[model samples]
Target: MFVRIVKMSFEPSNIDTFLKNFEIKKNDIRNFEGCRFLELYRDKNTTNIFFTYSYWDTEEALDAYRHSDLFKGIWAQTKPLFNDKPQAWSVDKLESLT
Candidate 1:
């Protein structure tokens, strides 16, 4: 499985708006093809900092989602709220303790 993590830092005032958008779109995103899991996390010490954790069947699957209309819409709405360039990483799981 491919594990993807995206760390995003939003302008302080835009954090609530971003979370609202995510709350509205989370289900749709999670239902996308090859999306095995999806979640959002916030830094306890920094409310404007967030991360998205997800799993995909493969890199191709993730790329497909990235190009989907769902992503285009959500991303376009969210992009302007960034306080800095987002960081993303993809990992291949060697083993899982669980």
Candidate 2:
């Protein structure tokens, strides 16, 4: 499996807007081709910080999602809400307890 994690810090006043946008797209994203899992996480100490942790069947599967129109539209709306450049990583599992 390919794992992707995106860490984002939202503009304080734009956090709600970001959440609303994310809520609207989350389901479609989960249902996208080759998606195995999807989740959203928040930083306990930083209310405006969030992360998306997802699993794809392969790097190519993730690339397909990134190239889709759904991604283009959602990302256009999402990009301006960031307080900082987002951090992301694509990796394969070394080991997992579960």
Candidate 3:
């Protein structure tokens, strides 16, 4: 399986708007082809910081999603809210204890 992690830092005033948009779109993302799982995380000390942790079937599958209209739409609403350029990583799962 392939894993994707995205770190996002939003402008203080835009945090709520970001959260609302995320809530509306997350289900569609999770159900997108090749997506196996999706989750959202927030930094304990940084209220404006968030992360998306997801699993995809393969790198190609992830790439397809990135190029999809769903992603374009979500990103259009999301990009303007960021306080910093977003960061992302694609990785292979090394091990899972449980």
Instruction: Show where candidate 1 strays beyond 4 Å.
Output: none
Which run of 10 residues does model 1 get worst, by summed lDDT? 89-98
The residue-level lDDT of candidate 3 at 88 comes to: 99
The Cα local distance difference test for each model comes to 0.95, 0.95, 0.95
> In candidate 1, what are the lDDT values of residues 1-98, reduced to their tens digit?
88999999999999889989999999999999999999899999998999999999989999999999999999999999999999999988788896
Q: In candidate 3, which residue pairs get closer than 3 Å at backbone N, Cα or C atoms, i.e. clash?
A: none
What residue pairs are clashing in model 1?
none
Candidate 3 residue-wise lDDT, 1-90, digit = tens:
989999999999999999999999999999999999999999999989999999999899899999999999999999999999999999
Sorted on lDDT, highest at the top, how do the candidates line up? 3, 1, 2
Candidate 2 structure lDDT: 0.95
The lDDT leader among the candidates is 3
What is candidate 2's TM-score against the reference? 0.95
Relative to the true structure, candidate 3 reaches a TM of 0.97
State TM-scores per candidate.
0.95, 0.95, 0.97
